[model samples]
Target chain A: MSRDENAAGRTMLEVDRLAKRLGEFSISNVSFTIDEGEYFVLLGASGTGKTVLLETLTGVIQPDSGRVVLAGRDITRERMQRRKLGIVFQDQALFPHMSVGRNIAYGPASSGMKRSDIEKLVESLASGMGIGHLLDRGPATLSSGEAQRSALARALAMGPDCLLLDEPLSSLDSGARVEIRTLLKKLNRGGMTMLHVTHDYEEAVALATKIGIMENGTVVQVDTPQRILTHPGSEFVARFVGIRNVYRGRLRRESDGTSLFESGSEAPFRLETLCEAIEGEATAVVRSEDVTLSAYRPDTSARNLFEGTVSEIVPARRGAEVTIDAGAMIVAMVTERSVEALGLERGNRVFASIKASAVRIIEG
Target chain B: MIISRIEPMHLIFAALGGALLLFIVAPLAGMFLNVGKAELSEAAADPEVTGSIRLTLLSSMGATLIAAIGAVPFAWILARKDFPFKRLVNGIVDLPIVIPHSAAGIALLGVLAPGTPVGSLGERLGVTFIGGIAGIMAAMAFVSIPFLVNAARDGFAAVPVRLEQAALNLGASPLRVFLTISVPMAWRSIISGLVLMWARGMSEFGAVLIIAYHPMITPVLIYERFGAFGLKYARPVTVLFVAVCLVFFLALRMIAGRRSHVEG
Candidate 1:
C-alpha cells in the first residue's frame, strides 16, 4: 500500500494491528477506530487490557506494532501532550493547591488564553459543573461526586478533540455512580466523543452507543448494544452477555438445504438452525426473552417442542423469569401477568417453545 | 468499621508524645529563663552574631531556592518514569539525610576544596568553596536536598497520570499539564519540602564547618561562643535564633496546611 492511501485509510482514531508485549501478559493484534464524535466504550473485566488500550491511545504506553491515527493524521510518533485528548481518571485527580476556579482555568490559561477570558470561562465552567459556590474552595474539600465533576469540568475546559475516561464511576458508591453515569450520558449527548472503559455490563449498556468487548488481549466483538446482548458473535460474547441456554451441537444440513442442529444428550430438542457454524460443534445463544413455556404441545412446523419440568421461577425487570429443564436450560421471561395465568411453580411439567431464528448460532 | 472516637491508647500515646515534646521544649524555656534584658541588649549589639545570622539566612534560603528549582524536573521523572537505575537515584537522595552530618561535611569539602577538581573547576568560573559563601550554600544544600526531592516526588506521584493525559487530550502540551494540573496538585508537598529544606539548611553545622569555617552560620557561631566565652555569651543569641525559626516554621505550616485542607 502507498503511504498516502494507507494514511487516508486511517480513521479519526485508528489503531492499526496494535500489539504490546509486557512480559507474559500483553495485548496483540488489536485494532479499532473512533469517529470524530462517537461514544465508544471498551468494556471488559479487570486485567483484560481495556485500560491498557486506552493508555496506548493516550500515548502512556507506546504500542510496539500499531499506528495510532487521530483526525486523519498519523499521531503514532506524537507525544502524549500533543494528542489533545481529555481524560478523567478513576480517582478524579484534582489539583490540591488550586481552587475550583483555578483548576478549571488551568488548561485554558496554559494554552495561551487571555487572563480575563480565562477568568470568565472558569466562572462559567465552575457553575456549569454545579460547583460555582465552591470555586474558592479547594479540591480536597469536595465530595467524591463533586471532585469527579470538577475533574471532568477541568478536562472539558481544555476543549479536547477526544475524551477518555478510565473507570470514572468504578470507585463511586451506587448512588454516586448512577449520578456520574447520568452526567456522562448527558455529556455524550452534547457531542463529546469519548472512549470510556468499564468492567460493568450495566454501565456499558447505560452509557455506550457502541460496545467493544475485550478478552485477553483482543476485542472479541464490537457491536451495538442490542447486537452484542442479543446476537453475540462468539460463545465468549454469549456468556458475557448473560445467555443462559447456550447449546453446543453439530449442524446437520439435509438434501433440501434445510439445516437442523443435533445437540448432544438424550432429550435434545430438534430445531431448524438459522446460521451455519464454522465447525461441526456449533453454539447457540438464547436470551431469556426468546423462550416461552407451553402447557401442551402447540401446532407448529418448526419442530422445536420439549417437555421439561419448571426448575426455578425468579424475578426480573417488570417480569418473572422461569427456568425450564427441557434437556437444556431454557430461561423464559414471562410478564407477571403470564406468571399468574400459568400459575408456574417449581417441578411443574411444561413444554418450552423457542423458534430457530431466536437462537443466535456462533461458529466455533 | 469501629467508628468510635480517639481510643484510650491514642490518648496515652498523645500524652507520652507531649512529654517527649516538652523534653525538646525545655531548652527554649531555659534560654528564656537565663536571659536578662542586659544580655539581650548586649547580644543585639554584637555585630559578629548579627552577621552570622544574616549569612546563615542567606545561605539557607539560597540552598532552598536551588532545591526548589532543581527538584521539580527530577521529581517528575522519579514519579512518572520507569527506567534503569531509578532506585539507585532515589537511594542517592537518601544518603545525606541518613549519614552523619560530619561525613557529609567532609564529602562536600573533599569535592569543593581548592586543589580538588570540582573546586578548581568552579574556581575557573570565578567561584571558590573553601571559606566562601558558595561552600556554605553547598553544604546546606547537600544536607537538605532529600526533603525537597522526596516531597516533590510524592506530590507528583499522587497525581494520576490520567489527568495529565486528559490535559494532553485537550490539546495542552506536556509542559502545560505539568504547570497546570500536576504541579498545582502536588504544590503542597513541594512547599512543605521547601520549608523543611530551608529549616535544615539553617541549622546545618558539620557540613558548613568543614567546607567554609570563616563564613560562620548561626550554629557555628553558637559553638564558637560556648567554647570561647560560655553559655552566658551564647544563650541570648540561641534563644533569639530558635524563636525566629519557630515562628517561621509555624507560619509556613499553617499556610500550607490551610491551603491543602481547602484543596482536599
Candidate 2:
C-alpha cells in the first residue's frame, strides 16, 4: 500500500482506528483518510456504522479510542465548532424556525462576521446553490430538493475545510438525487474535499474519487471506484459492489498455458481462462453486466462459456436480471430488449459467456 | 346541527364537561357582574389596590425572569442528558405542583426564616428573604419554577437533536447552538412556559402570605379586603384584578403568537 504516495498531497482528513461503542452498535477499529480535494465515499449497507463513523469524524460522537486528524491537527478532543467540519444529514435538518437566508447566515453571524458581510455571504451562497429565490422562504415551506440545497448552502457558508455528508442524497427523489449528485461533483471539482457516506452503489460510483466499503463496523476495502468495482478484495465487497456472480473454485494450470477453473463438487464444471494460473483454492468474481447471454453458443474467442438454464428472470432498472444455474448460480444483467429477443424466462436454456479479463480472482 | 354527529353518550359526556366549565366560569362572571362600574372605578383609584396590583405584576415577572436564568439550563439538561436519577429530578421539579400550597409555604418559611441558615447567608449578602420583595419573589419562584423547567424541557425535547448537531457542525458553539437553534426552535413552548409560570406566580396566595404579608400581592389584598369587609367590597377588587390579568395574559399570548408566526 503506497501510503507515502497516497499521502503525497496534503491530507485533509484522517480517521485513524476510531472506535465507539453505542449501545449494541459499535464502530470498531475504523481508519481511513481523505486527501485534499478528494470526494471520498464511505459505501456501506444500512446498520454498517457509516453514519456513526461520520459522526465520530465530526466530533459529534466521541470515539472511545483513536484520533481524528483534520488538516494535520488532531481534532479528536476538539469541540465540534473548533474542528470546522460541516455536515449535511439525509433529512437536511434545516432549522425550521429560520428562514433560508438566516439559516445559511447562522454560521458566519455566530462567528461574529459583520452584518453586511454575513448578508453578502448568504446571498452568494444562496445564489450559488440556486436557492436565491428561496432565501426569504421558511424552511418548512421548501420542498425536499429545495431543503437539500439550503442545507448545502448552510454548510458551505462556514467555508469548512471538508464537508461530511451522511447519505445526503438518500432522502431525495431520483431526480433530486441526480441533481445533488451533480452538485456534489461540481463542488469537488472546485477543490472542496468531501467525505460522503451512502449505501447506494450508484452514488459511490458516480461521485467517489476514493471508495471505502464498510461492513459490520469496519472498513473492508478501500480503493478507487473502478478498482473496487472490478477487483474487490473480499466476497463481501465483491457482492456489495454489484459483482453478482461469485464462485469458489480451484485453479488448475493447463499444459496449454491456460487455467481451468472448476467450481462446485456436486456437479463440477470447468471454465478455461487466459490468465496466470495459481494452483490453489480461489474465489472468482464476475460482474452481472460482464456476462453476455446468448440463445446459442456462438463461436467466439471468449475464454469462458457455460450452457445453463435460466432459473429466474426479474425486471431491474433499465434491464432484467437473469439468474442462470450453470453448475453454480450466475446472474447476468441483460437489457429488456435482449430478454424479449432471446425469449428468456425461468427454465429457458441459455449460454452465458464471460471473457478472461473480466473474471476477477481473489485467492484464499 | 353541529351536535348531530355526536353520539348520545358523547353528548352526555360533553354536557358534563360543559357543566364543569360553567362551575369554574360562574363565580368569576358573577363577581364581575356584581361589581358596579362605580365600585370598580373606586377600587382602581384606591392607592393600596393599585399598589398591590403593581407589586403582583412586577414581583411575578421578576420571579419568572430570575428563575428562568437557572431553569432554562436545567431544562436543557433534563431534555438532553442521560444522568442517573434524572426521572427523580424531573419528579422533584414537579413536586411543588402536587404538594399543597400552604405546605409549600411552610417548607419555604422553614428555610427562609430569619434565624435559618439560608436567611443568615442572605443577610451576609445584604439580602433578606422574609417579609420583603425578595421573599415574595422567592416564594412565587419556588411555586412556579417547575412550570418553566418542565415546559422548557419538553420544548428542548421536541427540538431535533440533529438540528443542534447541524448548527454545531456549522461552527456554532454548544451555547450558541442552544440559543440560536434549540431555544428559538422551542420558543413557543418556552414562551408558554413563562406565561404559565408568571400567571401561576401572580395568583399565589398561601405561599406568598407566609413569606411576605406586608407587601401585599393582589391575591392577598383580595383576601384581606374580603376578610375585613365582605363579598361586596372584595368583588370590585377581584373583578379589577381579574380583568387586568385577562388583558395582560391575552396581550402576552398575542405577542408570543405573532413572534412565532413571523419567525416561522
Candidate 3:
C-alpha cells in the first residue's frame, strides 16, 4: 500500500498478524496499522481481547507470533522499556508512592535525562493536562479524573510517537468523561497519534477518526466512524453499534425501479427500500432514532408504516425507548416531551414509520 | 470524658486485657525498680558487660544487614513469580521459625563443622564458624532471617503489579522498576522486617549458645552471670540491656511510623 493513502502521514505503527494465547482467551492473527496523527479507536465489548491486544502492542505481554513495526523499525523483539510506546490503563495506574510531579517525571528520569530538564518537561506536561497545581500532591489524594490526567501526562512525558490508551475514560463520571473527551480531541488536533480502545459506542463516536470493530478475538470491521455507524459490515457489528432494527430478508427488484424486502416466510412482512443490488438474501438495519412514533397515521412521504401495540416504554437519557410489536419487533427513541404529547404507554396502539432511505441493506 | 462511651462489657474486657498487659510490664518494671542507681552504674561501668552488649548490637546488625541483601530479592521473587514447588520454597523459609532454636543450631553445625565442605572452605579463607563471631552471626541469622523474608515478601506482594508495569512502560528497566517502585512502595514492610530480624537476633540464646559460647554476646553473658552469681548480679545487667533495647526499639519504630506517614 502507498504511504500517502492514509489521511495522516506514514504509518506510525503497524501490527501484523499478532497472536497470543493466554489460557482460554487468545487473540489470533490480529493486524492493523495506525497512521501518524490519526486517532484510531478499537471498539469492542469486554472479554473480546481488547486490553490483551493493547498490552501486546506495549510489549507488556509478548505476542506468540507476528511483528510489531513502529516508526519504520521492527520492534517485535524489543523490551518494553526500549519500545518507546506509552500506555494509559483503565485504572490510570498512577504510581501511588510518588508525588504527581515525580510520577510524571518518572519516564524522563528513567531515561537518565538531566534533573532540570525533567522538571521543566514535567511542568510543561502537567500544565498541558491542566494539572499543574496538583504537582505536590500524592497520587492517592487525586480524584479519578485528576489521576487519569496525571497518567496521561506521565505517558506523554516520554515523548512517545504514538500513545496506546485502554479505556482511558471508562472509569470517570459523566462530567469528567466529557472533559477528558474534549481533552483527547484537543490533543488529536495538536497532531498527536493515538490508538485508543473502548467499549462505549458513544465514546467511539465522539473521539474516533477511524474505528475497528472487534469480536471474540479478531477485527471484524475497520472503517471511518461515520461508515461504521451508517453501514455496519456484519450482524454482530450492527447489533453492537446500536442499530436496533436488524432483520434477515430477501431483496427482489420490482418493476417500478425500487426493491422490495420480504422479512420472513410465514407472515412475510414486506417493505419498500432503495437498493440497486441484484436480487439476493440480505440484512436490513435501521437506527432506532430514525423510526418515528405517532398516535395516529397521517399523510406523509414515508414508505414503511405499521400499526402495533407498545410493548415497553423504557426511560433513557433525555428520552424514552418505545418498543413496538408490529408483527416484527421495532424500537423507536422518542424524547420525553414527545412521549407526553403522544400519551405513549405500554399496550397503547401506535404507528411506527420509516423513510425508504433510512433502511440500510447489507449483503449476506 | 471517655468514661461515658464505655459500656459495662467494655469495662470488663478492658480490665482483662489490662491485667494481661500488666503481667508483661510488671516484671520489667520490677527489675528496673529493684536495681539501685549505684548498682546500675556499676554494671554499666563493667567492661565485660559493656563489651558483650556492644558485641550483641553490632553482630545482630551485621546479621540483619547481610541477611537482607539476599532475603529481599528472594522475597520479591517469591511474591512475583509462579514457579513449580514455590510452596515448597516458602515452607522452607518458614521452617526456621517453627523449629526449636537449639535444633536450628544443630542444623547449622551439621553443615558448618570443621571437616564439612562449608567449614573447610571457610577455613581456607581464614574464617571459622565454630567459636567465632561468624558462627554467632550464622546462628543468629539462621533463626531470625524468617522474619525479614516473610515481612518483605508480604510487602512486595502488597505492591500492585500494575504499578510495576506502568513503570516498565515509562522506560524503566526491570531493576529500575524494582528499585524505584517496588522497593519504595514496600519500604514500610521491609523496615519492619529488618527491625524484627534485628531484635530477634539480639535476644537469641539457644542457637548462639550452642554455636559460639565464647563470643559472649549479651544473652550468653546474662546466662553465665545468672548461673555463676545468681540473680543479684544478673538483675542489674538485665535491666541495663532491657533499657537500651527499649530505647532503640521505640526510636526505630517511631522512625518507621513517621516515614510511612510522611510518604503517605
Candidate 4:
C-alpha cells in the first residue's frame, strides 16, 4: 500500500468504477490510479481482461460506465484521436506501407507539425531507441526487436503525458524481450509515465514500481512489487506470484517463546516460524529461492531444517529447481554451480534449511 | 514414410485441368485464325465498329467510377461493422451476380424506365436513362457492380483493424486514417476489383439490350452483326475486340502490380 518516493504523490491517470462488456466477458467496477513517473504494471494470466483494460484506457474501447481522467482532463467520452494516449500493441502494428521514419512521424504530421521538425523528431527518437539506421527501412525487413523499437519510437513521437503498452514484449524472443525490457526501464527512469499490461510475473517484477494483480476482470490487489511478492494479499495472489511452498497448518506458541507450526493431513510436517498470530489454523508461504540445500547438516542461524531426499531436478530460469521430499514436499532453487557442488541428483539424500523469518504467514 | 513421387491422382488432376484450359482457349483461337488480316482491317476501319468499341470502354469506365464513389465506403462498412440485417445486405450485394441478366434488366426497368419517378426526375435534370448512354451505364453497373463491392470488402477485411486503431490512437482523425491508412493498404485489391467490374460491364449483353439497344456497345454490335450477317462478319469483329481487350487488361494488371509493390 505504500507508494515509492519517486511517485511524488501526484496522480497522472485515474480510473473510477470503469465498466465494460464485450460479449460475455466484462470488467466491472475497476478502479486504480497511476502516479507521475511511476511504471505501473497490470499482471494477470490469459483471459483476465488485461488487454481489454488497456484498450479501454487508450480510448480504443468506450466504457459502459465510469470515468477516465488523464492528466487532470476527463476523457471518458473523448474520441481516441483526442485522448492523447499512446499504445504499443503486442504485434507492433507499424504501418507497413510507410517506412520506419514515416511511421514515427505519423502523429506529428497529423498534428500539422513542420516537415523539418517532424524529421528531426523521428531521427532523435529512432536514435534513442537504437534504431537510427533503420529509419529508411520498411517494417517487414526488420527483426522482431527492431520492429518493437520502431513501435516504441512511434508511440513516443507525440510526447504524450502517459503511455499504455498492451503486452508489448509477449511476442518477442528472449533476447528481444531483454532488450525491450531494458529500454522500458530506461524510459521509466527518464520520468516517462507508463502503464504496462502483461502476464509475465518476472517482467512485472523487473520493470514495475507498482504492480496490480487482476483476477476475473477486477483489480484484486495493488502494491509495491516487493510487498506483492513477499506479502501476497490472498492465496491466489500467493500462488500467482510463484510462492512454491504453501501449507495449510495450525500455529502454536511454544514455551520457549517461539511459534511452532504443524501442517495437516498426509505428509504432515512442523516448522518453527516467526508468526505473531494467536494459536489457531493458518497458511504458510515460502518462496523456493529462500530455501537452501546442503549435502550434510551443520550448525546455522536458520531455525528450521529438514532432511529429505532430492525427488526431482528441473531446469528453470538460470537455476535448477530441486524438489526435496522431507515429511512434506519442499522445492528449493539453486544455481547450476551449487547443484554440481552439492552433487545433487534424483533420490540423493539432502538437507533443506529455511529461516524462520522466511516463512510468511497468511491468516484466513 | 512420406511419398515423394507423383501418383495416379496427380496425372488425373493435370489431365482434367488441361482439358478445361483447352476448352477456354479453343473458341478464341479459332476466331482469331479464321479472321484474315484484310477482314480485320475492314472491321477496324468501320466507324460503327470503332465507335461502339469506344462507347463500350467509356461507358464501362463511367459506370466503374460512379459505383466506386459509393462502393468503397460501403465496402468499408461491410468489412468493419456488424449491424442488423448485415447478412441480408451482403446477400443483396451479390444478387446481381446470381440473377438472370434479362431479369436484372427488367428489375432496372421497373425503377428507371422513362415513366418511373427516378427516370422522370433524371429526364427533368437533363440526364435521361432510356435509350441513352446513361441507360447503358446503369445496366452495366447493375450487373457488374458486385465485383467491385466484394473485392473492396475483401481488401478492407485483409487490412488489420489494429493498424487503424493504432493510427487513431496516434492522434490521426478517423477520416485521415481511412484516407491514409485503410485505403492505401487496400489499394491493390480495390484496383483489381475496379478492373474486374469494368471488364464485366464491357461484356454485358442482355441488360444493355433491354435498356439501350440503340447506342450499341461492342457486345451488342457483335450480336447485331452475327444475327444479320452470320459467322464470317462476326468473327472479324470478335477477334479484333478480344485483342484490344487483352491489351488493356494486361496494362491495367501491370499497373496494379507495380503500385502494390511500391506502396507495400
Candidate 5:
C-alpha cells in the first residue's frame, strides 16, 4: 500500500494489472512498481508467475491485459527491442558463440554505441564483475557464480533502465548462491534499480528493501520482509513466510475480560487479542521463533506457558529449530550450543512459553 | 563384460558398407590405373575438357549462391514456424534427395524444358535451361535444394529461441537478432549445409544429362567420354574431380574445427 514511485526522476517501471495465460497456467491481475534505485523482490514458489512477471516487464511477453509504463512512457506496445530492460535468466542463457567480452559488448552494440566505446565499456564491466581475466574465455568455462556475474555484467553493459533477474542464484550451490547474492547486493548498492525474484524466504529477507508475495498470479501482500513474516494478514502469507504455528481457535470472554482461546488443545490458553470475541470463535497464530524454549517455567508477565516434550530438531543454517510437542504443536529456536546446554533431544521433556503480545488473533 | 569380437550385426553392416565402398572406390582405382600419361595429357590438353571444367565450376558456384540465398530463409521458416500441411512441405523439400538422380533429371526436364509455363516464362526472360549454363544450374539447384535447406534448418533449430528473445529484450530489432544472433549461432550448420549443397550440385549428372547434355559439365563430360572413348580417357577428369572435392571437404572440416574452438 506504500508506493514511493516518485523519486527525483520519473518512475523507472510501473506494471499495471498485467495478465497472461499459457496452457492451463494463468498469471492474472499482477501489478507492481520499482522506483529508481529501489530493490524490489518478488518472492513465490516455482511456477508462481515470478518469471512471467519479469518477462512481462522485459517485454519478452505481451500480457493479455494491463499496460507497462517505464519512465513515464507506455512500453506495453513497444517491441522487446525498444523496451531496453535487462534480464538475467535462471539459466544464464549466455551466447555460447561469443566470448565473454563479445557477450558483454552485445548490449552496447545493440544500443548503437561506437565499437571502441563498446569495447571500453565491456572492459570496464568485465573488470568490475571480476571477470576481466576471463574476457577471452568462453562462457562454458566459467563457474556458475562467474557466469551469473557475467550475465549481470552483460545486462549492466546495455545501460538498461532497470534490471530484472529471475532467481539467478537458485541453481547454484550454497557458496555460489552466497557469492552471486553478494554481487547482486553490490549492484543494488551502486545504484542499480533491480527487481530480483526468488522462492527462498531468507534470500528475499536479506536482499530486499521491499518484498511482494504472490500466489496464483496475484500479489496478496507487499511489505518489508519483517512485516510479511511477523504480522502476516492471512494464514497463507504466514505459512508462506515459514511461520509454523497457526491455529483455528474459539475466543471466550473470560471473567477478568481477558480473551481465553482454546486451539483444540487439552486446556485453553489466554491472550490479549484485538479481534472481537462476540464472534464465538476466531483464528490464533504465533510464529515458531516467537515461542521461547526453556528448561523450566518461564517466569514472566508474558502470557502463555506449556509443558511439552522436545519432539524433533530441524537443522537450519543459523541454528537448530526446536519443535516441541505440547497438547498443541509448538516450535522454538535455540542455538545448537543452547540445545546442548539445555540437553534438548527427542522425547526429552521441555517447557515452551510464548508472550501474549506475540500471539496474533484473526477473524475469518 | 566387454565382448571384443565383432558381433554378427556389426559384421553384416561392415560387409554391406565394405561392398558399397568397394563398388565406389574400385572404379576410381581402376580408372586411374588404366589411364597412362598419354590419356592424362590428352584429357588435359583438350580445350573442350578444360572449358567444361571451368563452366562446371562457375555454374556450380552460381547454383550454390542461389541455393544459399533461398535456403537460409527457407530454413529459418521451416525451423521456426508450424502450419497446416507443414509436414507435406517438408516432404516436398526432401523429395529430390530420395528421387533417383535420373528421376530428378527427368523431373527437371519436365519442369524446365521449353513447354511448361515456367520454361516459356524463362524463355521470355531470356533464360534457357537446355544447351546452356542456366540449364545446368537449374538441375543442380533442384537436386541440391534439400541438402542446403535441411542443414540450415538443423543449425537454426540448434539455437535456443530464448537467445533470440534475449536479444530482442536487449533492444535489437527482429531482423537484427536474426543477423546478429540466430544466423551467427547457427553459422556452422549453415556453412556445413552450404558445403553439402555445393558438393551435391557440383557432382550433379543424371539431371544435367537429361536437361542440358550439350553444355557439358564435368559429370556430363565424364559420361560422354566414358560412352565414347571408354574408361581410360574419362579417368583423368574423374580423378581430378575427386581431388578437387577432397580438398574442399578437408577445408570444410578444418573450418568446422576452428569454429568449435572459437565457440568454446
Candidate 6:
C-alpha cells in the first residue's frame, strides 16, 4: 500500500508511553504510531532520547514502562529476534567477515530457510538493492553507499514487519545521502513500514509523512511536516522547524473574539492573533516569510502592522532576512529583487505587515 | 626516499633496541650454530627423543583443544559482560601466566592428586591425574590456558556490539549470532591464541616434571638428558625440538593469517 492509502490504515507499530533510562539521558512517556506503510520520522536534537527510543522499540533496551505493540501484539518485552523488526544503525554495522551475499543470507539462514531458498532470497535482495554484483565482494571493499545498501538488504532478508533506521544518512556524503533517501522512499512506497530517527530536520521534512518532535525525552508534538513548519506546537518546535521570529509573552483575550499577543517587557507590543487560546502565557510564532516589508506604511488590511527600522539584513538562501527593531523585534524574508526595489539596508525605516492569521499562538 | 637527519639521541635509542634484539637472538643462534648435522640426525633418530617429542606434541594439542572449549566461552563472557568483580575474574585468568609454572603444577597437584577432593573424585571415576598423561595435560593447561583466554578476549572485545545487535535484529538466536558473527569476526585472534597456548604448553618443563615424571615430554627429556649427560648431549635434542616448534608455529601462523585474509 502507498503512504496515502495507508494514511488512516491499520497501525503497524504503536509505541505507547515508552520510558527508558540510560545513564543520565532518559526517554520518558514517549508515544507514537506508524501506519502500515507510513514513513514515521522521529526528529530530535543530540542528547534527545531518539536512540534510546529506537533501542526500546527494537528490544535492545527494555523500557521501564509502557507497551510496544507491533501488529496488535505486545512486544515490549519480546526477544529482539522474535520482534521481527529490522534495524539499520548509524554505522551500518555490516558483518565484516562475510561477503555481501552471505551477509544478506544471514537472516534467512538463521531462521532455517532452505539453501536454495536462501540463495534465491539473497540474490533477489541484492538485485533489488542494486548490489547484485557486489554480492561476491566483502563489506570492507564496498563504498559507504554500497555498504549501506548491503546493510539494508541484510536487514530486509527476513521480511521484517517494520524497519527501524537510526541516522541512516548521518555518515553519508550529500550525494550518497540523496541516493539512500531515494532508495528509502522507494522501499517505503513498496509497503514497508519504517520508523526512521534523525536529528536533521530537513531529512525529516523531506522523508517523513508524519514527524514526531521530541524534547527532553518526551514527544512534544506529532504532526505533518507542513503543519509543524506552519503552526508549531511549542517554542522549541517553532525554533526547531526554522521559524525565525518567536516571542514568549502573555495572550489576552479581547471581547471581540480576537486574541492579542503582548511580547517584551521594556518595549512591549501586542499583535492581534487568531488562535483559540483565551488568556495565558503564550509563545507567538511568526514565520519570516509570512511577514511582508515595505518602504512605507502601504495600504493593506493587515491587522498587525508596525513601523520599524531595519536593524539587520542578512543574505539567506531564498532571499534576504530583514530584522526590524520596532517596539518588538520582527524578522521578514524579502527577496533580493525586493531588497533592490525598496533600497532596503541597515538602519532604514520600513513598515512590516503581518495578518492576524499569520500569528500562531501556543501555550508557553 | 626522503632522508631525514639522524641525531646522537636516535643512535643511542637504536643501539639500545638493537642490544635487546641481539640479546633475544644470541642464545638461539648459538644453539643452532653449535649443533652438528650428525648429532642433530642422531637426536632426531633416537626413539626415546622421538617418543618424548611425540608425547609433548600430543599432550599440548590435547590440552589446547580441551582448554579452548571452556576458554573461548569464558573469554567471550569476559569481553561482553559487565558484572561485579570483573577485574578480579580477569586477574585470576591471567594468574596462571604470571605465577611460576612449578608453583602452578603444585597447585594443580593439590587439587588433582590422590586423597584431595578432586583427586578422590577422579579416583572414583577411574581417571588418574597424578603421574599420568592426564596430569601432564593438566599441568600444560594450567600454565598455558591464559594465552588463549587473553587473546580470544581481545579478539572478541574488538568486535563492535552493534554487529551482534544487527544480527539479533535479523532474527538470529543469540547462539546463532555468536557462531555466525562473533566467532567468524574474532577467528584470527582465537587461532593465534590457540597456537600460542599450544606452543607454551609444548615448552612447559617444570610443571610437567612436577606432575608427570613418567611419559616424559620433550622439555622434561631435554632436562633429563642435560642433567644425566652434559651440554653436548642436550644441545642436539634442544636444537631439533626448537626446529620442530618453529616449523609448526610458522605453518600455523601462515594458515591462520591466510584464512583471516580470505574471511576479510
Q: Judged by lDDT, which candidate is best?
A: 4
Error of 6 at A362 (Å): 26
Question: Candidate 1 DockQ score?
Answer: 0.46
**Could you give candidate 3's per-residue lDDT for residues A38-93 as a string of tens digits?**
99999999999998898888887889999899998998889999887899888999
Which residue window of length 10 is worst by lDDT in model 5 chain B? Answer: B31-40
CAPRI tier for the interface of model 3: medium
lDDT of 5 by residue, A1-364 (tens): 3455464634677888889996766788887777778888888888787777777777766789898888778999787878767898988888888888888988888879999899899989999989999998888888988888888899888788889888888878777886787788888889888888889776777678788898888787888765676557666776687676656667777777677667755565455554443545455767777888888776776678889998889775667878887876777867888888888889998888887777766532
Question: Per-residue CA lDDT of candidate 2, range A1-364, in tens?
Answer: 1347545578888888889999978999898889999999999999998878888888778999998888888999998888778898999999888889999999898788999999999998899889999999999898888999999999999989999898999899877876887788889999999999999876777688899999999998899875787668987887677776666678888878778777856798666666563677655667899899999986877888889999989787769889999887878999999999999988989999999888766543
TM-score of 1: 0.73
Candidate 3 lDDT over residue span B1-264, tens digit each: 566575889889999999999999999898989999999999999999999999998899999999999999999999999999999999999999899999999899999889999999989999879999999999999999999999999999999998999999999999999999999989999999999999999999999998999879999999999999999899989999988888888999999999988887
Q: Which is the better candidate, 5 or 6, if ranked by lDDT? A: 6
lDDT per residue (tens digit) for residues B1-264 in model 5: 998887899999999999999999997787667767776777677888888877877787799898787789889989988899999999999999889988988877887888898889999999987777898998899998898899999999989998988877777778888998889889888888887888888888888888888878999888888899987667888877676677877898799769866765
Which is the better candidate, 5 or 6, if ranked by TM-score? 6
Summed over model 3, clashes come to 0
The candidate that achieves the highest DockQ relative to the unseen native structure? 6
Model 1 CA lDDT for position A109: 73
Which ten contiguous residues of candidate 2 chain B have the minimum total lDDT? Answer: B1-10
Q: Write the per-residue lDDT of candidate 1 for residues B30-121, one digit (tens) a residue.
A: 87888998888788788987888888988899988976788887899899999999989999999998999999998878888788899999
Candidate 6 lDDT, tens digit per residue, A261-331? 99856787889998876477667778898999989779999998899998989887778889999987888
- Angstrom error at residue A338, model 5: 22
User: Candidate 5: misplaced stretches above 4 Å?
Assistant: A1-10, A244-364, B1-20, B100-127
Chain A only: TM-score per candidate: 0.67, 0.70, 0.70, 0.70, 0.69, 0.70
Supply DockQ values for each candidate.
Answer: 0.46, 0.58, 0.66, 0.64, 0.57, 0.68
Model 4 chain B weakest lDDT span, ten residues long: B235-244
Pairs clashing within candidate 2: none
Tell me the lDDT of model 2 at A243. Answer: 75
Candidate 6, which segments miss by more than 4 Å at Cα?
A1-7, A244-292, A295-364, B1-3, B124-126
